[model samples]
Target: MTSPLSSSPAWKALLAHRDALAGATAADHWQASPERGAAFTFPCAGLVVDFSKQPVAPETLALLCALARERQVPESIEKLFTGEPVNVTEGRPALHMALRGDEHAKVDGVDIRVEIQREREHFRAFVEAVRDGRWKGATGKAISAVVAIGIGGSASGPQLVLRALAPDHEGPQVRFAANIDPAELDQALAGLDPATTLLVVVSKTFTTEETMANALAARAWLEAALGPAALAHHVVAATSRPDRAIAWGLPECNVFGFAEWIGGRFSLWSSAGMPIALGLGMAAFDHLLAGAHAADLEFRSTPLERNVPALMALIGLWNRDALGAPHHVMLPYAARLEGLVLYLQQLEMESNGKRVTTTGEPLDRPTVPAIWGAPGTTGQHSFHQWLHQGTEAFACDFIVVAKAMGSDPDRHARLLAHALAQSEAFMDGLDVPDAHKACPGGRATTTIVLPSLDAMHLGALIALYEHKVYAQACLWGINAFDQFGVELGKTLAGRILPAVRGENAALTPATHHLLGIIHKLAQSD
Candidate 1:
């Protein structure tokens, strides 16, 4: 039988190596290194990755790679390409790669090429119709605006892609509403005419509470404006359960479907990207897919010692498991990339934030760290102080773009400078005679340089992180695809909602007390 990950030889050797390197800092390696530490940077999928500031020695890397070999990271990657049901718990293959035109990708012994291509054509026809003014709203006017609705995976990925790729959107004006908050939908619908607006309701099951609530509200809003018959023309759906969507009032022509093998968080490349295609055009969307496919090739074929995502995953394991760091920060220099952090939070946390393994045994070591951060320069003002002097030990991933979204050379130059300066300050501290002025240095950071913020690069960046999440999950023996942990609260919320709506449902005393206060407050309204 295979040993537990904690008791494996490579893991034990690392534990010993951890004791061997005491009192050394990342700064120490920088000064004593050759080539001014330039060798630490690796060119990967069009980005330059520098791990010099991670505070790991050559021996540390060798041991970590050994651990990866023992964990069979390469084989895990192969299974993904070969369409194995790596997501064992769900009994499904997490083959989002098929969404990007992977010819060999499959599910249930059927190659997805023919099916995925057919779906792609259907997805394109709808998006092209809307973009080219061929599809009209209930009032027989070409759609000029869109309100995209869905929560979590259905929402975050496409929302971020459109924001990052199309800042000045020249196509149909697309606004996204993900939160169940009435204000979010209200804001998205504000000042837009129902006559010319289209709604893309994205949900895998077509019954997610938050998504359906928002979709129904938006449908009602449209019905009030254009009448009940108009919704057949006004609302479009991207879901696996087209029957539920059709039962809920969408026309059969308005429904687009993806396979059960696709997860929501990874669904942006699927029919979930309907909004992205409408907002950014099919050409841009295709470029995004191409970039991700390129990265997939790199991740699937590259050697373990130098693979980009593998290195990212291993270094992350070292930080969380060996150093005991509990959190990681992603600081993107471009503001449009702000959603990148939100997207990653769900990708890393929801995927690997588990207490149990794939077999349902307790996990012995830490997995993914709590992921959080804002866009840089802005983040510099918000959290730089704490990062520089805070008692907490955490890792930072900084994203630096060679050129920004704008054409102002001076502004981009200064933005790049600030990112570099902050990264340097993070790795090396200053000595001060004043006790209050001293800065704690030696914080580990990994800086990634994006060639530019185009669709291709953005796709590669997102896919790179996806593989990183998968690699870490493989190491932890966790089910990266299933999220049973999130289901209980949603189920309980379903039970609790009726009680809050004046029903005589039984409740805990504290909940009743809170509900009473809320009800009493409503009386004043």
Candidate 2:
């Protein structure tokens, strides 16, 4: 029986080929072809993707494509677009695409597109009311600030949107609080009047520990400034379980219900994205969806050979498996993309960093490289040292926007120059005389060029990575939608909470000792 994937003929061929390219350097490949830059770069949906500096030869790409064919990548793409229940463990189709207008998906023998539109209309009404002062605070004041309270995708998507698109859009003073730490909520709520503040609590289950904790705290803070009656007008929830949200002391009208197929990380496209509409205008949110839909079409219609998302997945797989790089870094030259790395950490790692296959068999290979990074030229000062001279080499993606944030052409030109120079430096290093200054630059890097940073561009950028993660899971034979790995930590934290409160709950010796010290410190305080 074929147990591990390594036993497959295609997997074996890729493995054999991995060893043959062991001695080659990225510099050698960069010099191997005159058309390397033109041949390796591809454009789709107004974004340019350059994979020329990925430490792979044309032969390696051909072999990777052959492996993709052998692994049925085209079939996987069809399965995803056709609304198959690819997320087998949950017995549900990951129809987040339906929220973006995938016409062919049906949930429970009923068309979900109509339901998605209904939900969107329902939430859009609420957003319009808040934006227009029709939905006033309990004290009859129009809200000027909106504090989005959610953990993970719920907060990250909205925060990233507000930060990236803040220059172009004029909306509410949007802020996000995700950590259970009191300081985080304290800072988010600091100096804001509760009468002019609107709270959006997002959770799929209405029961996420961190989310609910912050939600309750924010409610209490708002109640202290206003009254208990203020919660009806001051707070709203975006969740699948609207009944539970209403029961948790929100008005029924305040709860925006979504379908169950929306995974937390992918829910940004669903009603969980209501905060995006609230933070930006409904028009910006609509543009975000339109941009994502365009990418969805690009991924759906383009063949694997020319598909941008497909090529990203295949190249990522080659870097992770064949080239043996364990870390991938994101370096966006645009300051607006500051949160892009954190967004991708949860998007890629939470989705594909799995140990077992879909059928519950152990995987013989690493699933995902550790996804982490910072915005550049900032990262150039911080982690670029490690990227250039560290003993371990990593895969990097340099995201550069052609247009600057403001009208300062000189600063933007310098930023663009530094971005290109870094890529070149990474590809072709200086063979200097001084040993301390010598930099061995054989790192694999990809340059993704965006015309500008906007809601539409952000939408396409996010969708590209989302599909890439899903395709990587398909290639690895793992369930990308299910994230059972995060449960154990949550469970342990639940049991440990009582210990922190000075209760005699069960605990390991190490934990008990730690709790003792914690209690002693609290007593001193």
Which candidate number maximizes TM-score? 1
TM-score of each: 0.97, 0.97
- Those runs of model 1 whose alpha carbons end farther than 4 Å from true positions after fitting are 1-3
Clashing pairs in 1: none
Can you write out model 2's per-residue Cα lDDT over 188-259, one digit (the tens) per residue?
A: 999999999999999999999999999999999999989899999899999999989989899888888888
Q: In model 1, where is the ten-residue run with the lowest total lDDT?
A: 1-10
TM-score of 1: 0.97
The parts of candidate 2 lying over 4 Å away from their true place are 1-3
Candidate 1 per-residue C-alpha lDDT over 1-525 given as tens digits, one digit per residue, 9 for 90 to 100? 123678788899998898888846789877777554675677777878899888888788889999999988889899987888888888888889877756676577777899888889999988898889988887789999989999998888988898888664679888999999999999999999999999999999998989999998998899999999998889999998999999998889999999888899999999998888898899999999988988888898898778889999999999899988888999999988989999999999999998887888887887889999999899988888999989999998999899767978899999999999988888887779986888889889999988899898899899999999999998888889989888999987877898888887878888889989998999995
